[model samples]
Target chain A: MLFKNLFHHFGRYVIMLGSAFSKPERASMYYKETMRQMNDIGIGSLFIVCLIAIFIGAVTAVQFSYQLDGTLVPVYYIGYVVRDMTIIELAPTFTCLVLAGKVGSNIAAEIGGMRQKEHIDAMEIMGVNTAAYLIMPKVIAALIVIPMLVAVGAFISIIGGYLASVPTGVMADADYIKGLRSFFDPFNVTMMFIKALVFSFILTTVPAYQGYHVRGGSIELGQASTNAVVFSDILILVADYLLAVVLTS
Target chain B: MIRTEDIFKSFDETEVLKGITTEFYKGKTNLIIGRSGAGKTVLLKLLVGLLEPTSGKVWYDDTDFFALDRKQMRNIRMEVGMLFQASALFDSMTVEENIRFPLDMFSTLTLKEKRQQVDKCLERVNLEGANANFPSEISGGMQKRVGIARAIVLDPKYLFCDEPNSGLDPKTSIVIDELIRDITIEKNITTIINTHDMNSVMEIGDNIVLLYQGKLAWRGTNEDVLESDNATLQDFIFASPFLQRLRDAALKRG
Candidate 1:
């Protein structure tokens, strides 16, 4: 039944896509929605993503250092620890977890409210494609904003790890920087970007699709919002595992 | 100006519009009247192409609405207006923005021209001074007026209103009904309104289509409706004891 509904909805969007190419106003609305979503979803949540990154980086650095043997796993390699941990896993996947919590629920709740209020129907009646007008802008904005958030988070996490290593007498600043410079891999950085891009798509489109399909009243809208976040979060985790295994293997 | 042929729409096994066929003429207030779940709203949606009929065709003049391409259909839709049940004003937009939306979509008017059109619509709906106010800042009646302004902003040839007076008080409902009727006649626009209010049916039902159980049970003018002897429509009409008493008294006088 869900698949059937999905097909029906997809066909509706195909019509929207065809119409969008010919209609400048539709395209303008898409840009407007993108700008609105970028402000609403991305900028508003930046502080929280940054805070989480800094704290998590500091804690992970402290924990990794405690387990290291001074002779073999030298304290100078703490910079390598921060870089690898951030670029490999923490930045792309976990930051999305945060966005899935904040942004995913918000998109769902908003679209659900519009649906309940019959705005979508009104749009249809007025020759507006609701998905093209409402959903695509958010998708484009999310695609742009999420990668930026990942980059910011990665930078902040490294700074946090540097702060954690500051009081440690064993790790010299010069040695840490040297380690960071020496171990840097273009492949690792590339992989991190690929992961961030994929994560952004999953974090954005899935929640939006769920939110777009929401129906009935306020109770159902609340349920749809919760469902969008939970399902997107789970998908993000599952996607992370698959991408990690596939990329690293 | 609008005609439905054997329209059949259902959700799962439950029929919402069961092979209903009807005609709505131009230059008048054509009201669709029924109780809740009488397929009044469903029929309105179908008429406006918000939902495709399961097994029927809707014609706007000579063009089969379902057979038209997106561009052509959109061209047709541009000439049409709808006032939704919930008002459906954009929460993020001010009254002026909402009124300007349709014009912005379909017109090549410059920004100043758009503003002029917006101001004109706002004035028509008696909402001239509330241009900057958000939907949340307005009362239900004001919101409905804004919805009306937005709907008619493009000077549409056709107007579809679903429960225009649904949440308003009796006096407000009359005001809204009168406004719709006045606008319909003034512009000579083909207007179809979905309503359950008997007061509306009596006040401005130039042409009224009565539905029962998703079927077109009766269709006639407002005067013909009170005089209609069709049992189902009569039951629907006289369901209110006050109306029933009025009908009985009229019958006695005759």
Candidate 2:
């Protein structure tokens, strides 16, 4: 029964995406909507992304310094550990997980509200492709903007680690700088971007699908919003694990 | 003209609409009236292609609506307009922007021309000079008028209104009904209204289809409603004791 339900939802979700990506009626209208979504999702999320990233980097630095207090591993390794971890996993994963709650729920609620209010029906009868008009711009905006936010997050996280380690006597500035400069593999950045793109797609489209298919009244709408966040976070984690295996191997 | 051929709609295991075949003529106010859960809304949704019939067909004029491809359906939709019960105006946009949405999406008119068209529609709805107010800032009657303006902005050949008087006072409801009636005549468009308001029925109902338990229970005009002998129609139209007394008095006086 569970498997059947899963397949049912999966099939419907695929069909919804098919309609969402279909040819738009007007390119100019879509462009305007995309810009609005970019402003909402990208600019709306900057502060939270930056805040979470800094704390994650700081905690990682503090814990690693404690672990390396009397070890053969040099204290400068804290900088290296923080850099690689932030680049390879923490920045993209953590930031998007937060966004899955913030932006994902908002999208679900907004679109679900529109559905309940019959705004979607009105648009459909006006000859607008509601799925394409409503969902595509959001997906496009997320795809473009999320990666850029993840990049900024990664940079801020490194600075956070530097501040935690060097300014707090956990390590000397010279040693931390040496660790940061050493053993830098560019492939890690590629992995970060891959995760960012996949996570972005998951976060935006999941919520949109939830919203688009919502039924019933305000209670049902709230449920859809919650489902959007939960499903998006789960999918992002699953994709993260899969990408780590594929990209690393 | 819009017609449905044996339209049936089912959800899960329950059938909501059962073989509802009807016609809405051009330049007439065609009303679908029923008690709550009589499938009036479902029938309306099906007629507008919002819900696909389970085992039947809908025809927009001579074209089979369900048989059309996506692009073809969209092209046909360009000639259709719907006024939702809640007005469904985009809350973020002002009245001018809300009415201008359809033109902005589909019309190739320049900005000045679009504004001119918006002004014209607003004036037609008797809502001129109220352009900058958002839907939230307007009364329910004003919102419904704005909804009408938006619906007719594109000069649609088919207009569907879902309970245009749902939340309005009787006077406002009468005004909305008359506005819709005038527009139907002026444009010669096929206008189908889903409503149960008796005032609307008597005032603007050019043709009426009454549904009882998902089936077409009765069909006639306002003139026939008072004289019809159909038990289901009489039971529905005169459900209240006060109305039944009035009906009896009218029959005695006649």
Candidate 3:
């Protein structure tokens, strides 16, 4: 019975979305909503992203430079390692993990609170499409801004890594740039984009489903928020590993 | 008119609404009076298709509600207005925007036309010039009035209110009740209210249905209720000190 109800709501949501997507006006509203959601996710999340990226970059460069020990593994290769790791894994996938914890929980909580408070019902009573009016924007925003944030993360980390690698003195500035440029792979960039796209969809859909299905009052709303973040974050990590295995294999 | 036939709803093991049936009249204030756990709110939700009944049917003017498609259900909801116990006004929006929400959603009315309707509804609720105030900016009674204005702005054919007078002084409660009753009469809408407040039962209860433990125990008009021989209803009515004296005097004469 639970499965049946879940499937029914999923089916209804799909059909409603199919119709909305076909309508230009509705689609326009979706674009606007997405932009609004993106601003909320990206702009509000800047501080955390920058903080994480700088530390991860600096730590990675310092560790690699120290391990190299003036030998075959040159200190300048820190930039290459940082670039590869950031573009391939950290920027798109790990950053999304942070966002899922921050933004995903917030979206779920706000929507769940609205549901508990009957504001969502009131919107339905007033003839607003709850999914289109609420969920679409967040999905759109995440898709658009998450990729850009990934790029920004990549840039910040590489710079932090360069600074961290400076004291090692195993390789000169010219050698570091060459190794960094040499390590750049188009396949890794595509991988980053794919990861970003998948993360955005997962974060938006899971949290939205959780929020929409929320029952009970304010207390339940808080539970929904916590559940959305925990569940989505776990799924994202699992998906990241599975995708990594599939691509690597 | 709104009608429920053999509607049954259960939350897992506990049955909240057993085979219950009742009709709410058009252009009259119909009150569903019950104790706290009597499933009044559940019944209200079921009637409006918010919560699907476990068994039986709910009809809005002879049309079985659950039988309709999503589009049709949405269409039906547009004609139905509900006032929640908390007034349920959007905390984010001001009174004007809240009232204009329905118009923004359903109608293609110009901004001017929407504003005009908002002004008229606010004035009708005697809440004129409070349009710019947020829900938190106003008193609880004012919030209820804003809720009523939002409900009626769409010119709904049916109005449902769940404990509309739940948290207010007696004087303010009466004012809200009279406003709801006046709006029902003016629009000729089928108005159903779920409340245990005895004052509401007396103020605007042209028709009353007494729900006892998820079952329709007694149903009658205010006059009929005053003269009822039902012990359950007598106990409920006499729970109020003033009504107890009135019931005792009337019983002595009988």
Candidate 4:
């Protein structure tokens, strides 16, 4: 029974996405909607993303500094560890997991409310190809903007490490700067972007599926929103693991 | 005109509509009236392609709606407009913006032309100069009017209104009914209204279909209602003792 239910949902989700990728009845309307979504997702969440990144970087640096205090590893290695840890793992994963809760729930609620209010029906009867008009713009915007946010997050996290260690006397400024500039592999940055893009697709589309197929009243809508966040978080972790193994191998 | 052929809809083993076949005519206000669970809304949804019939066919003029490809289906939809019960205007958009959304999505009109069309629609719905107000900021009657404006904005050939007067005052209900009827005649469009409001029935019901227990029980115009001998129709139309007595008196006089 569970497998049947899963297959049903999976099939419906794939079909919904298939319909969402069709040709737009009008190009300019889609472009305008995409721009609006970009502004909302990118600029709207920038501050919170930056704030969380700084805290993550600081904690990682502080804990690593403690761990390395009596070890063979040099103090400058704290900078390298923070930098690599951030770009390779923390930036894309942490940022997207947070976004899965913040933006994912909002998307689910917005679309689900539209469903209940019959806006989707109205659009459909207008020949608008509602799946394309509603879902495509949001997906496109997330694909474009999420990677940029992750890049910004990675940069901010490194600064956070500096602020936590250097000015606080945990480490010397020269050693930290040397650590940051030392042993930088550009491939790690490429890996970060690939993770960002994959995670972006998951976070946006999962919530959209939940919202688009939502049935019943407000309570059902709330459950869909909650499910969007929970499912998105779980899938992001799974995807992170899979991408790590696949990309590394 | 639209025609249904042996339409049936089932939801998880519960048959909501059973072999319902009917015809709604052009340039007339066609009403589908029934009790709450008699499948009025379901039938309307089936007609508009929002819900597919379990095993039946719907015809739009000479075309079979279900047999069409995606592009052809969209071509049919382009000529259709629907007014939902709650009006379904986008909350974030102003009244004018809501009406202009369809135009913006499908029409090739320039910005000025689109604005002009929006204004014309708003004027027709008697909502001129109320362009910037959000749906939440307006009364329910005005919201319904705005919904009507949006529906007619594209000059659709087929308009579907579901319970267009559910929560309005008698005066507003009559106004809405007249507006819908006037638009139907003016545009020579096929207008299907799913409603149980007796005032709407007597006022503008050029064609009426009554469903009882998923089966179409009766169909006639407002003129036929006074003299019809169908017990189901008579029972539905004159549920109250007062109305029944009134109908009896009218029949005796006739």
Candidate 5:
């Protein structure tokens, strides 16, 4: 029964996506919506994302330095560890996990609210494709903006590690900078962007599907919103594991 | 004319409409009336292509609505306009923006021309100069009027209004009824409304369809209402004792 239900939902999700990516009735209306969503997801989420990235880097450095206290390992190795950790894992995973909570649930709630209020129906009767009008812009905006956010977050995390380690006298500025510059593979940056793009698609389309087909009243809407965030977080983590296996191996 | 041939609709194991066939003519105020759960809303949705019927055909003039592809269906939908019970105005947009949305999407008119058309619609709906107000900021009656303005902004060939007088006062309901009636005749558009408001039934019902227990129980105009002897119609129209007495008194005079 559970497998059947999952398959049923998967089928519906695929069909919904097919309809959502169709040709628009008018190109300019879609462009306007896409720009609005870009501002909302990209610009609106920048500060919170940067704040979280800083804390993740600081905590990782703090914990690693304390653990390396009695070891013969070079103290400057802290910068290397933080840099790789952020680029390969922390930046894409943590930034998307946070966005899954903030933006995913919001997309679900906004679309679900429109469904409940018959705004979608109004658009449909007006000869507008509600799925394309509502979902495509959001997906496009997320795809374009989320990778940039992850890149910015990765840069900020490296700086955060340096500030936490070097300013507190745990390491010299030269040592930290050398550690950051050491053994950096360009492939890791590619992996970061790949994960970011995949995670952004998952977070956006999952929430849009949840919202567009939501039924019932406020309680159901709330449940859909919660499910959007939960499913997006779960998918992001699973994708993280899969990408690590593929990219690393 | 908009016609349905042997329409049947079912949800789950339960059937809601059992072979409903009717005609709503152009330039007429056609009404679908029933008690709650009588499938009035479902039938209205089916008419406007919002929901597909279980096993029947809907003819939008010469077009078989169900036979059309998505693009073709959309072309038919381009000529359709609807007013939801809640108005369904985009709360994020101002009244003028809401009215201009369809124009922006499909019309080739310049911005100034669009604004002029919107102004003309607002004036026709008796809501001039309320263009900047959001739906949430307006009274329920004003919001319904705004909904009417938005519905007719494109001068749709067909109009469907679901419970347009649902939450308004009697006076406001009469005004809304008259406005819809005038628009139907003025534009020569086919208009279908769903309501159980008795006042509305007697006020603007040019062709009334009464559904009961998933079937067509009665059909008539307001003039034929008081004199009709259909048991179900009598039971529904004069369910209250006061209405029964008023009908009795009116019948004696005739």
Candidate 6:
């Protein structure tokens, strides 16, 4: 029964995505909506992304310095460790996890509210493709903006590591910069962008699907919003593990 | 004109509409009246292609609505307009923006032309100068007028209103009913309204279809409603003792 239900939902999700990616009625209207979503997703999320990235970098630097005490490992390796961690793992994974909570639930609630209000049905009767109109712009905006946000997050995290280690006499500023510049592979940056793109697709579409198919009243809408976040977070983590295995191996 | 042939809708094991065949004429106020669970909403949704009937057909003039491909269906839908019970005005937009949405999406009218069209619709709905107000800032009656304004903005050939008078006072309901009636006549558009308001029935029901227990139990005009001997129709129309007393007094006066 559980497997059947899972397959049913998976099938529905795929069909919903097919409709959402279909051709739009008016390109200009869609363009306007896309620009609005870009502003919301990009500008609205900058502060939270920066805050989380800085803390992740600082904590990692402090913990690594503690582990390196009275050991053969160089303290300057703190910079190396924080740089790689923030790029390969922290920036894409943690930032997306936070967004899955903030943006994912919000998309679900917004679309679900429209459903309850009959706004979607009204659009449909107007000869508008409601799925494409509502979901495509959001997906496009996230795809374009989320990678840039992740890039900014990674840059801020490196600066945070330097501040935590070098300013407090834990390491010299020159040594910390050297460690940051050392042994950096360009492939890691490529991997970071790849994860960002994939996570962006998952977070936006999963919540939109939840919102689009929502039925019943406020309680059902609330449940759909919660499920959107939960499912998006779970899928993002699973994708993170899979991407790590594939990209590293 | 819109016609349905043997329309049947079922959800899982329960059937909501059982072979409902009917016609709504062009340039007429057609009302679908029933109690809360009588499948009026399901039938309306099916007619608009929101839900496909399990076994049935809907026709807009000579076009078989369900037989058309996606693009063809959309072409037909472009000529359709709907007003929802809650008014369904996009809350994020001003009244003029809401009314102009269809024009923005489908028409190549210049911005000035669109604004003129919006003004004309607002005037038609007796809501002139409400162009800058948001739906939330308006009264319920004003919001319903906005919904009507938006519905007719595209010059749709067919209009559907799902409970246009649901929450209005009696006087306001009569005004809305009369407004819809006038629009139907002026545009020669096929208009279908789903409502249970008795005042709406007597005032604007040029044609009426009443469903009971998922089947068509009665069909007539506002004139027949008071005189019909159909037991089910009587039980429904005179369900309240106050209405029954009024009916008895009218009969005695006659």
Off by over 4 Å in 4: B248-254
**Per-residue accuracy of model 6 over A1-249 as CA lDDT, tens digit each:** 999999999999898889899988789999999999999999999999999999888888999999999999877799999999999999999999999999999999999999999999999999988989999999999999999999999999988888899889999998898889889999999999999999999999999999999999999999999999999999999999999999999
Across residues A1-249, which tens digit of lDDT does each residue of candidate 3 receive? 999976897796576456434333245446655777778898998888888888778787777777777678655576788789888888877788988988888888878888888888887766566866877777778888888887788778777777666645655777667768975669888888888888887787678777877998777888888888887898788889987888777
How high is the lDDT of residue A23 in model 1?
34
Pick by DockQ: 1 or 6, better one: 6
Off by over 4 Å in 5: B252-254
Residue-wise C-alpha lDDT for candidate 4, range A177-201, written one tens digit per residue: 9999999999999999999999999
Comparing candidate 2 with candidate 3, which one achieves the higher lDDT? 2
For candidate 6, the iRMS in Å is 0.7
TM-score of the first chain of model 4: 0.99
lDDT of each: 0.84, 0.94, 0.84, 0.94, 0.94, 0.94
List the pairs of residues colliding in candidate 1: none
Clashes of each: 0, 0, 2, 0, 0, 0
| DockQ-based CAPRI category assigned to the predicted complex of candidate 3 | medium
Candidate 5 Cα deviation (angstroms), residue A108 = 0.3
Q: How well is candidate 4 docked (DockQ)?
A: 0.88
Candidate 2 lDDT: 0.94
- Second chain TM-score for model 4: 0.97
Task: Name the candidate, 5 or 6, with the larger DockQ value.
Answer: 5
* lDDT tens readout by residue for model 1, B1-254: 99999999989889899888888889989999988999998889888887888899999988899999866787788889899878999898999988888777667889899999898888888887898999999999999999999899888899999999998999999989998998999999999999988888988998899999888889998899866779988899889889778878988999
Worst 10 residues of 3 chain B by lDDT: B100-109
lDDT (10s digit) by residue, model 6, range B86-187? 999999999999999999999999999999999999999999999999999999999999999999999989999999998899999989999999999999
Residues forming the 10-long window of minimal summed lDDT in candidate 1 chain A? A16-25
Better of 3 and 5 by TM-score: 5
Top DockQ hit: 5
The candidate, 1 or 5, that scores higher on TM-score is 5
